[model samples]
Target: MEDNDQRLQRIKKLETLRQLGVQPYGTRFEVKDRAGDLIRLHGRKSKETLEQERIECTLAGRIVALRRFGKAAFAVLQDGADRLQVYLKKDLLGEQTYRICEELDLGDWIGVTGRLFRTKTNEFTVEVRSLTFLSKALRPLPEKWHGLTDVETRYRQRYVDLIANPSVHEIFITRSRIIAAIRSFLIERGFLEVETPMMHPIPGGATAKPFVTHHNALGMDLYLRIAPELYLKRLIVGGFPRVFEINRNFRNEGISTIHNPEFTMLEFYVAFADYTDLMGLTEELFVRLGREVLGRTVIDYQGRQIDLTPPWRRWSYHQAILEVNKLDESVLRDRSSALAAAKQLGVEVDPNAPLAAVLNEMFEETVEPHLQQPTFITDYPIELSPLARRKDSDPTLTDRFELYIAGREIANAFSELNDPLDQRRRFEAQASQRVAGDEEAHLVDEDFLRALEYGMPPTAGEGIGIDRLVMLFTNQASIRDVVLFPQLKPEK
Candidate 1:
């Protein structure tokens, strides 16, 4: 609901403008220069130099501030990322034009034809020769001192937040730059960017509860993809050696500072590459992104200086758990012992969970938060990784690694499991877990298995959470801070 007094005043102003034969809302105004460019080009010029040069410019922007003294007024106009001051005089604009200006309010969009000049305070300004109204704002902006301080309101009404806060604007700008850098890095490495389906008959790429929908015509249930991994792998089987997709993924999961149901991910695969090779590539990509985006190989994230230099520390899953908790090695080698240790450490675990799952729970609860620096936890238990190949030396562990930085997992990669019989066994295990009431277990994707039967080459694939990457680079604490429009409950 609008304040009646303010709305009445603006409506009266609109009617008055109509009576004077002026269209308060304009169609098109030719803008020859932007306010920022004008300031950048001539801001350093001396008053005398500007006066002698007599530079003329036409610019358009939203009126952000206004101050009036009878027939003279000063207003600040913001265009793009820059702001410029405008000086309006009743004598220069004539009585009719000055009256139109008097009706203007802050938040109105307008165009002005003016000459560059410097005020006595040495502030660059535009001396307006004429003005045209582009649009009107009936309601006033939020108070300047308080600003849009409510967190929920800021996320709900992002446009107002952008207008009230300049820092928010820069975060989104950096987000675009980060994505562009990723594309440039991949394209230069001969990776072909491709699109994959967002809806799938079965969600198999990742272990996550999926958002389900019904297809009316087919009378079958479909799931919004939790990852593009399955489709991208199918492409590899079809003979596209190197491919990548930067797209959205949907998961039916709890919401938190670090979790959003719908989010962006970057999934890439390379034939003839292994998990170790991807680790090196991941290091190069991170170093390049840090240097290009922040101009440094080390960045301050949430007050911790995280170095992006390559050769990040590598540790096995069990080794990382031991480093963090000092648990005896025997405790992790058997399900009953791991479950007992997990109970002693106050980490929750299912009574019937396998040894690998119990150890995983302990590691996630104890070790993940302490991984402040970039590190890789490699050689996961075979039960924990359904799609990764088993290591040659240790068949119980799979050739997989997860990159952790700033106390959170940023990337997960593994050598693809190409053996059809092995993949069938893994899928069967996952199906059993699903039937045993694990909603997050992967479904058996027969189509993916069929594709694998055609014989895919030895390959490696990785998925990176783009939102978390943006948070790391932008120094944001919450995933919502980086996502432009995060999921939120309806306002009461």
Candidate 2:
């Protein structure tokens, strides 16, 4: 809701502009330079130097602040992430134009034709020679000193948040640069970027409840993708050896500081590579990103210093569970003992779950939080990973690894399962779970099985949550802070 007094004042101004035959909502205004660039180039120039040069420039921006001095005024014009002060004089504008200038309120967009000069306070200033009405802002901007402080309001009205908080703008800017850097790094390594369908016939990639929608013409249901794993692998089978995609995945799940229903992920696959190869590649990618984006291998994340240098700590699943819970190895290998251990740790697990599932539940509840630094947890149980290849030495465990940073899983990678018979068996097991009332179980994708039968190369694939990565790089604690518009409850 707008303040009544301010609304009336703005409305009166709008009427006045209309009476003057001026269109309050404006069109294009030619601009030669940004306010920031103008300052950067001539900020240090003396007033005498600027007056002698008589540099003329045209700029357009919203008026953020105004200081009136009867016949003269100084207004702050903000263009994107930069702000500049403009000096307007009644004598130069004459009576009619002066009145127009006087009636102009803060938050209005205007184009200024000006000459650059320095004020006595050593600040770079623009002396307005002429002004053009660009756009009228009815609602005033948020209070300058406090800005848009309410988190809910900030997320709800992100445009206002961008205007009020420069830091927020910078976060999104950094996010773009980070993504660009990732693309550059991958492309340099001979990886081709590709697009995959956001709607999947079967959610066969990961174990997560999906958002379902109907294609009325097709007379069937489609699910918003939970992961791009299955389709990316199909591309691999089609002979696109190295491929990557950066896109959104939707999950019907609980919201939290770290989780969003719709999120972005970077999924990539490379042929002739195993999980170990991917571990090295992951390390290289992180180090390169840290240096290129942050200019340092070490970053400060939520008050803790995280080192992104090579050779992050690696711990096997059993080792991590044993280290965190101090449980005997045999306890994790037996379903009954694992269930009892999970109960003792106050972790919830399905009574009918296998030992691997129970152990994983225990690890999530007890161990995941302690991984504050960059670390990799490897060699997950076969029951826990249906798509990862079985370990050569241990058939019960798969060649998979999850990268954790700041006590959160940042990336999951595995050696791709290429054996057609093995994939069929895995899919069958998953279908059984689906029939047994597990809503999040993967549905058997026959087309994907057909692709696997045609033979996919031994590949290494990984999915890194882009939102979580942005949160880490931006030092944001919540996923909402990095996401432009996160999901929220409906207002009454």
Candidate 3:
């Protein structure tokens, strides 16, 4: 009811301004300067210096705050980066312009031409010589909704959240810088950035259920890509020595603090390189990002300090599971024994799950939460990494590594499995599981297999979760905080 009253009052003001032939919703005002830049350039200047300089400028921003005192007034104009005090006097703006300014309210967009000056109180400010009413806010901003304390409102109405909180703006600014830094770093290293199709005939890149869409013209279903792996690898077969893509991936998965259904990934493939090579490259990229974005090699995430310094702890996957759970190696030998071990340790697992799946469950339950520092869990089981090359030392384990930090998986890398025959067999195994009620199973993409048959070189590929990486750098606890618009349930 109070909101409706405010709306009505603002509407009346709009009508009155129209009567006066003053354009309340205005056209362009030449904005040659911004509040933040003005402050940055001249905040320290003395009153005498500012008066002597007589710096005149045009500015525009939302009227975040207003204080009217009869014929004189003060307001805070919030531009993109910062806010500045604006003073309006009846004698200066004239009666008609002052009346027009009187109609203005909080959240209205206004433009002004002013000279930089120091207030009697010694604060730097803008003294308005003229005013241009750019826009009028019908409803006033909520007084209580000033920050991210109201989670649902903050996520749902991000515009208001951003307006109310300066810190929110900084996070996204840092996000942009991080992405730019990554792009610049990769380009400097001769990695060619490329684009791949988001829709796939068969989702085979990763073991995850996909969001299916239909092409009415073709009368066929296409899946939103779960990963860009196969398409990027196809570029490898096509002879691109180094390729990278920073793009979106969709997965039909549950949401959590760390998980989002639609997210960004930085996937790259390097020719003539193995998974071991990618480990060093991954560490270098992360450490560089830490220094560039956060200005430090060690960062505090959710109260725990994580070191992004090089030579991060590396442990084989089987070793991590055994050491973390204190379980005998026999439990990982077969499904039956693994299930028995999981039951005894109070770790839940499906009785029919494969041996490697059982081991993964144990690892997630025991090992993951303990990986607070940046660590690489390497040599994953062949069953778990269908697209990775088998280690020469052990046919059972693939040359794969998953980097974990702050108890969350940040990147996945592996040596490319170029043998079409091995890939087909793995796909067939996954297909059987899909038929047997596992929806998150890979489908045999014959086209991808055909591309591999054309001969891909010895290459290593990796995907770093950009959202999670941003979360770490910005110290955001939730993926939703990092994502501009996270997947959310329908608003009631």
Top candidate (TM-score): 3
Q: Which is superior by TM-score, 1 or 2?
A: 2
Q: Which stretches in model 2 have alpha-carbon errors above 4 Å?
A: 144-146, 350-352
TM-score, each model? 0.96, 0.96, 0.97
Please provide, for model 3 over 1-492, each residue's C-alpha lDDT reduced to its tens digit, 9 standing for 90 to 100.
989999999999999989888887888788999888899899999999999999998999998888999999999999985999999999999999998987888999999998999989997889999999888888788776444478887888888888888688888999999999999989999999999999999997888989999999999999999999999999999999999999899999999998899999999999999988989988889888888888899999899888887898999888988888787888878678789889988999888777878888999998999999999999898889989999999998899999999998999999999999999999999899899988998988899999999999999999999999999999999999988888899999
lDDT (tens digit, per residue) of candidate 1 on 34-76: 9878877999999999999999999998888899999999999
The global Cα lDDT (0 to 1) of model 3 is 0.90
What lDDT does the true structure give each of the candidates? 0.91, 0.90, 0.90
Tens-digit lDDT track of model 2 for 187-236: 99999999999999888688899999999999999999999999999999
Q: State candidate 1's TM-score.
A: 0.96
Question: Which of the two, 1 or 3, has more TM-score?
Answer: 3
Give the true-structure RMSD of model 3: 1.3
Q: Cα lDDT for residue 220, model 1?
A: 97
List of clashing residue pairs for candidate 3: none
Evaluate residue 102 in candidate 3 and report its C-alpha lDDT on the 0 to 100 scale. 79
User: Could you list the CA RMSD of all candidates, in the order they appear?
Assistant: 1.8, 1.7, 1.3
- Candidate 1: misplaced stretches above 4 Å? 1-4
